[model samples]
Target chain A: MTAVLCRHFGLHHMDIAEDIASDTFLKASEHWALNGVPDNPTAWLYTVARNKAKDYFKRTAIFETKVRNEIIPESIENEGEFDYNGRIIADSQLAMIFAVCNPANPSESQICLALQILCGFSVEEIADAFLTKIETIRKRLQRGRKNLRNNSFQITTLNETDIRSRLPIVLRTLYLLFNEGYFSKTSSKQVRIELCSEAMRLTLLLTENTLTNTPQVNALLALMCFQSSRLDARTDIRGEAILFDEQDKSRWDQSLIQRGNYYLVNATDRQEVSKYHLEAGIAYWHTAPADDSKWTHILQLYNQLIVVEYSPITALNRVFAFAKVHGKDKAIVEAEKLGLEQNSYYHALLGYLYAQTAAAKSIAHYEQAIQLTKSPTEKRTWQKEITLLRQDKR
Target chain B: MKEFALIFRLTDISDFQPSPEQMQERMNWLGSIAARNQLVDKGNTLLPVPGSAKTVKPDNVVTDGPYTEIKEFISGYIVIKAATIEEAVVIAKENPIFKIGGSIEVREVLKRD
Candidate 1:
C-alpha cells in the first residue's frame, strides 16, 4: 500500500502515503463490519483506497491546480483499477526499501523504519526483536522520520547510477533485520518467522529486479532460506531454546533447504564472495547430517566469515566450529583468549568445551552462564544441565 | 463417521495483526486436516483484520459489536468428519491458534436424514 501510494503522492510524501494506507484500512474495518467483506477483498481495498486518495488530493492544499490535476486520479471507477497492480507495486516497494535504508540515518533507525513502514511491524514487535523498550523504538523511528521530513529527502528511485554502490547499506539493513527476527530470544516463533520472511521477501525483490539482481542478493536470500528451514526446530514445544545438536533433524523443512540450495547455486553465478555467501555456506552445511566432512566445511566458512567481518561473536562462533573441526582442548585454548565473559553464549560454549576435561571448571562455567543469561528459558535449560553435571563431579 | 464443528474462539484479539507467516501457518493447519480427508467444510473466519461479529434477533433487531464484552469471540469454525468427539478433539489440538491463546470447542454436529 505504501508503494502504491508513493507513486501518486510522490517520494517526498512517503509518510502521507503511509497515513492514507492506514486510513484506507480503518475505512475497510468500519465499512466491512457494517456491510460485510466484499467478494474480492483486495479489489475492494484497492478501489476504496483509490477513491480515498482522490478525495484526499481534492481537499489538501499541498498542490496547485495544475499539480492536483496531474497527481490525482480522475475517478476510482472509471479506470477499472479494482485489482491489485502487482508489477508497479513491486517496483515502488523496491524503491521504498532503498529509500528507507538511508545511509544518512543511523543503521538502527533505518532498520526500525524498515520494520515499521515496510514490514508493517508494530513498535512493540521491533522492540521485542531488538530486546529494547517500546519508547526507545518509537523515539528512534521519530528521529528517522524527522531527518527525512526536515531535509525534504528526495529518494530519486530512478537513479541506477549509484544503485549498485548503495546496495551494501540496503543489504546490511536487511541482514540486521533478518538476524533480529531469526535469533531474537524474547519474540514468539510467529514473530521470528514473520520478520525473517519479510527480510527474505525484500531480498528476493532485489534478486528479481533487473538492475539489483546481484550475486550478493542471492547469497542473502540463500542464507535466510537456510536459516528459516531450521526455525521450527530451534525451539521446543515449551518454547525453550534448543541448541543445534539437540534439535530434531526430521523437523527441518526440507523444501526450504532445497530452495536455499537453488539460491546458493544462483549466487555462484559471479566470482565475488560476500559475508552472506560464507554464512549461507555454513548454514547449508548445518542442514546436512553432522559429520567430520560437514564440520570441516563449516569451519572453513566460519574462517572466511571472520576474515570478511571480524566481530567478537563471529570469533566465538568460529571457535565452536574449530572445536568441531580439530578437538575440544585446542578450541578451548582459542575461546579462553577471546575474553568474552559478558556473553552468555560464550560462557555456554566454554562450559561445553570443558565438560569432558575438567568437570569442576565446566560446572563453574555453566553456573556463570546461568548468571549472565537474561532469558528465563535459557536459564532453565542451563540450570538443568548444571544439576546433571554436578552428579558426575566426583 | 459423525460430523463435528470445531469452533475457534480467540481471547482479546484487539491488537492481533496477523503477519504473512501467521496466515500461512493457519492455512497449513487447515491443509493438514484436509489432507487427512477429515475436512467436511472449510468455514469462514471472523479475522481480526476483517473483524465483524453481528448478533441478529427476531423483528429487525441486530447488534453491531463483536463479543468482546465476554473477553472472547468466535473467530472461526470448521466441520470435520470423525468417528468420535475424542477423534475430533485430536484434530482441534493441532490448530496453530492455541499458540496465541485461542481455544477450539469440538462439539458434535446434529444431522437430520
Candidate 2:
C-alpha cells in the first residue's frame, strides 16, 4: 500500500507516503478492534489509505500544490477519484523493486532495501538473513534510501533494455532471499518458510507480467519450487537439520515437484541457458530417487554450473558429487585444489571422504570442520562423525 | 477489563531518525495490538529534550526542563485495556521500543467514579 501511495504521489514524497501508510494501519487497528474486521480487509485498507492521502493533501497546502504540479495527473485529480485495484498494487510493488534495485546503490544495499520495503522484512530479520549485525543492516538501509533520494529515482515502467539490465539484480536478490530461508542460522521453521515463500511470491509477480516473462525468471522460479518441495524433508521431527541423503523422500511435496517441472519445461523454451537453469537441473536431480544415474547427472550439472557461475559453496557441493561419480581419493584431490580451508563444508566433505580410507585422517578433518563452524547443528553433525570415526579406528 | 498505561522510557533516539522502514514495522506492531481490541490510545511521540519542555516550580516559576541530568525519559505512552498488570506487561513486551534497547513500564490506571 505504501508503494502504491508513493507511486501516486511521486517517489520524492516517500516520507509522506510512509506516514500515510502508517496512519492507515493505525486506523485499521483502532477501527477493527471496535468493530470486527471488515469483510474485505484489503479493499477496506486501500479505501481508508486513499482517503487519508486525500486528507493529507487537502490539509497541507504545500503538498497540494506539489501534487497538482508534479505528482498526480490533472485528469485523475479532476475526476476526484483514485481508482485502484490489485493489478495497480502489483505494478507499484514491481516498480518499487526496480527502484530499489537501482544500479546506483551497491548490490547489498539493493537486496536489503528490496527485502525491507517489498517483503516487509524487519531490520533484525534482514540482518539475520544476511548474517550481519543489525547496525550494519541499518546503515545499509540508510545509505540505500539516501541514494534513492539523491538520485530522484522514480518508479516507472521499464523498457526492454532497462529490464534486461535491471532484472538480473532483482533475480539475484530473490535468490539470496530464498537461500537465506533455506539455510538460515536460526532454528525457527516459520521464519524460514516466510522468507522462502516471500521470495517465491515476488518471483511469481515477475512471471505474471509480460515484460518480465523471460526464461531466466522461469528457471529461478523452477529452482525455488524444486528446492521448496524438499523443505518438509529437510529437517527431522525434532527440527534438526537432515542431510539430503538421509531425508525421507516420501515427505517431499509431489505437487510442488510437478509445478517445478512445469516451470523447468517453460525455462528450456529459450535457447539461452542461465545459471538458474543449471541449478534447477541439479535441484531436479535431487528430487529423483537415489541412484548412480541421478548422481552422474547431478555431477554433470554441477560442472556446468561452476563454469557459468563459481562460488566456494557450489565448488564444495561439486566435490561431494565428484565423490559419488568417481572415488573418494579423486574427490579429495579436487576439493583440496579449491583451497577453501576456512569453509566448514569443505572440511566436512573432506572428513567424509577420508573416513572411507583413513580413519585417523578423517578424525582430524572432522575436528577441523567442527572448529570452523559456529552453527550448533553443523558442529553436532561433525562431532558425531568424529566419534564414529574414532570408534571405527578403535 | 482494566486500563493500563504502557510508558515507553529510553535515551533520546531523535538523532538516529529511524528510517521509514523501521517506522512501518513499529506501526505494524501497534496495529496488531489495536486489532486485538487492547489499544485504548495510540499515544504521541514526545519531542526531544530542549524542545517545548518546561518544568514549573512550586512557586510558579517555569524553568526549561526535561533535565539532561537524567539518562532516560518517558518518550511515549499507550493506554491498553487489560485484565491485570501482568496482562499489560505481556502486551508491552511486544512493543517495538524494546528492539532499540528501550524499556516499557506497565502501570494500572485509577478509575474515577
Q: Give the TM-score of candidate 1.
A: 0.72
**TM-score, model 2, chain B versus true chain B:** 0.83
lDDT by residue (tens digit), candidate 2, B1-113? 89998887877556236676466446545644553446677777765556567666687877674655676777777788887888788778766777777888888889889
Using alpha carbons, what is the TM-score of model 2? 0.73
> Which lDDT value does model 1 have at A321?
79
RMSD score of candidate 2 (Å): 25.4
Give per-residue CA lDDT, model 2, range A60-135, as digits (tens). 6556567665554432362254657888888888888777888889888987888888887889988877678999
- Encode model 1's per-residue lDDT on A90-123: one tens digit a residue: 8778888887887779999999999988899888
Q: Comparing chain B with the reference, what is the TM-score for each candidate? A: 0.82, 0.83
All models, DockQ values?
A: 0.01, 0.01
> Which regions in candidate 2 have their CA more than 4 angstroms from the true location?
A63-81, B1-113
* Native-interface RMSD of candidate 1: 20.9
Native contacts kept (model 2)? 0.00
Clash list (residue pairs), candidate 2: none
Q: How accurate is candidate 2 locally (lDDT)?
A: 0.80
